[model samples]
Target: MLSKEEIQRYQRHFPLPDFGVEAQEKLKKSKVLIVGCGGLGNPVSSYLAASGVSCIGLIDSDVVSISNLQRQILYKEQEIGISKVRLTAQKLKELNHHVEIEEYNLNLNSKNALSIIDKFDLVIDCTDNFPTRYLINDACILQNKPFIYGSIYQYEGQVAVFNVNKSANYRDLYPTPPNPESVPDCEIGGVLGTLPGIIGSIQANEAIKVICGIGQPLIEKLFIFDSQSMETRVIKIKNTNARDTITGLIDYEEFCHPNKNKMVKEITVKELHEMIENKEDFQLIDVREPHEVEIATLDGELIPLGDIPQNEDKIAKNKKVVVHCRSGARSGQAIQYLQGKLGLENLYNLKGGILAWADEIDPSMEKY
Candidate 1:
């Protein structure tokens, strides 16, 4: 059913033995939903569009920031502060006018996950956090759609095919979410710029293989790659009874963060500024990495989040202690650990971390 121009455009694909006009036509009929428009989303969407995927659905609420330029290749410096899904949709349309692009400039949560995913033929997990990943897994399973999973950490990345033919899903690999504090995202733990490109391409390839019904897709197997060593390995996943437990979607955030009910106390940057102006007797702790301190700092004692366990004595017990990071996420994690493990009652999280201080208190300070 391809037009003459379409045949000529994808003529290169017509010569392959198994993947010829038929497979290309299959691609032209497939609908894919990519969750998260960050590093992994960039290459996955690009290649799938270029390969003639009929429709692509992009869902992400985050805006482009300076920190994303390192791995998110689809964005430019000029596009900073713009919606990521909207910009990515425009770029993909420019790449292939034959493909349809759907943009949802909103975060994917339990309330919207099932409805949105049910419209697509398949889903791709490009998210960086555990809660969203679990949300995608459950939704895709409920909709009876397969999903491709990809994740990058520092120099290592992982890719896997889940829920194809009712096979193993994410929960089959990870029965429960890990402690949030133990896992650091790309912002806290740096990722090589080229890592996502490699892993995402593999994910896109798996999607094509599944759609076209051609070669062996990575069903029930996880692909691990290390860019630093140029090494690769595949681990076979055993299907479990976990799928029986997923009858409906629940609150993923509360599920992943078991200590959500035990809220941490927070102090605004203005309040901290007032305290500093008043010469209050309080301890300020920086929980960011050493390299981050070099860029910008609040002159607080350097105790990175990882080192808090060993240096618990350094945090003053008698004085009010304020913990901060680039944003408040890591600092909140630090305070949670300090309070839950050390039973410290004097800890407080600096709201919005150093970025807020740079914006409100010290306008001259640099922000990452």
Candidate 2:
């Protein structure tokens, strides 16, 4: 039963014909687990808490960075480097003290995914990576719990409801994980600041619908939204009996990253600095976008990742070539492509990319 204060706080919700006192009470009794307390997680948790979900469990191991300020709304500029889950929990409590916030300041892995997910009635996939997404899917399938999946890339976002009443799971839509190199995260491929807000609110709406037993949730349908064009599409998904094969959790990292054994060669920022000091002959290629170069760069020849294939002639073949990006991921991808497609033997990824350079070699360099 809602207290007098609780009733007053959620008075706006009490008026909806379909969502009345009983629905609000249902919300107050529901437990939700949100994985990845970044972008999407920010608005999902915020609206759910504000809507009076009884308990919201937040799980994320990341710390706040300046880059997160663009889309992650719950954090402040002053809170940089603070634990994401910790600050998010504090903020959610402040928003709705009537709601309980459980913080898990650790990465979700195979060992803990089932145990943690078992605690919540429903799970929301706000995670950016594929490994965690697959992990959550399998864990939820095993636990027989439903999950709302949301993802944002550049100006586009996707939201889906999986395993609700034994409906289509993520694997039914994507039988296998895509190549990790092909899928650049929000950090590599930027997202509009407001994109998460749009998608996450929809996810929260679906969650409430699921909890309250009101309107039709996004079951067996994938909702895609493009912020640039303000367009939307819903695709029907057919279950392929993928869940029948799921006996237990496997190493999601290995599952998603099939080429994990083929490691890319790397050179530390400090080593690059030493080579610069010694005036050694080497080619430093920046694979980051042009805008990222304006933010912070090591003055390397600008060759964006997309252009790397055509601009291979520009990269030095005789001298050692070190490719870099904002962080090392993109550059490593560039190196992998060069090595595989062109069979270039002299390429090395700048370990940690320009971020590492800023942290280790140059204190004055701007970091985004």
Candidate 3:
């Protein structure tokens, strides 16, 4: 039931023998939910909308930043300080107004995963952390929905399809999440800006195949790509005993490794405000780039996360150093870095990062 204009808009795709008006219509009818609108989510969500997916739900608890402009193609410099979901929704609608786009500006957690996945036909896990990935996997399995998973580290990326029609799941491949400290992020390890783009596009293609019901889906197979060597390899995964243990969606973080994250140095938003008021003899350091401070807070010292190791001498080892970034993600790494280098036991992370401070303490402060 595409109108004359709709047919004209997608004329290029309709003529393809394998993907004609019927496949396009199927795409127009399918609902795909994308989690974590950051690196992989940005490209995956954009292409799905441009390809005419009828309903694309984006779930993210992040905002646009200047640093993200390098790879997250959907955002622009002007959109800095805006919610990732808000800006992404506006742009995707402009690209293809024919589709429906839903935005959730809240973080994904065990409490709301089921209700969220229940609304979409398939879920795409573009999240960066292991805890969130495991949560998405368990939710998809519990809801009996297929999920496309994508992850990138430095110059390498991995993509796979899981929990489709009771097929092999994430747990079937990796029984437990890696130790949080053991896995370094793109921020610390440095990822190629174009890495997620390549991986996310593949994820979008997998979702289209899942919806069109054509081509062999990447079931029980994990595809790994290395941009440096320009090589692609697929690892075949066999069913594991972990499948039998997952009767229902249990706590993913605890299931991964209980008490492992108990040592994470975190403080509540309230605790931070109290420190600022009491004028506690502590340095509230903002580890994001200098440009990021123009849009966000604590207005503290600017030592980008990348330069932490070299700039340790600049930090006050005697006084408490309360470190933070856009979200609490980078600060945790920063605290860990300092502890290992200077053994600064007084180092603390601004819990939930500056975002929590913006939400709880100072709403007037721009959230970027």
Best lDDT goes to which candidate? 1
Which residue pairs in model 1 clash with each other? none
- Give the TM-score of each candidate: 0.94, 0.93, 0.81
In model 1, the runs with Cα more than 4 Å from the true position are: 261-263, 277-279, 357-365
lDDT, model 3, position 357? 82
Q: Candidates' lDDT values, in order?
A: 0.91, 0.91, 0.84
Mind sharing the TM-score for model 1? 0.94
Error of 1 at 96 (Å): 1.0
Global local distance difference test of model 1: 0.91
Candidate 2 wrongly placed segments (more than 4 Å): 261-263, 277-279
**Is 2 or 3 the stronger prediction by TM-score?**
2
- 1 against 3, candidate with superior lDDT: 1
Ranking by lDDT: 1, 2, 3
Model 1 is weakest, by summed lDDT over 10 consecutive residues, at 257-266
lDDT of 2 by residue, 1-368 (tens): 98999989999998898998999999999999999999999999999999999999999998898899988989999998899999999999999999999999999999999899989999999999999999999999999999899999999999999998899999999999998887988777779999999999999999999999998888999999999999999999998889998999999888988775466788898999999999999998988888888888788999999898898789787889988898888888888888888888898888888878888888898777
Each model's RMSD to truth, in Å? Answer: 2.0, 1.9, 4.0
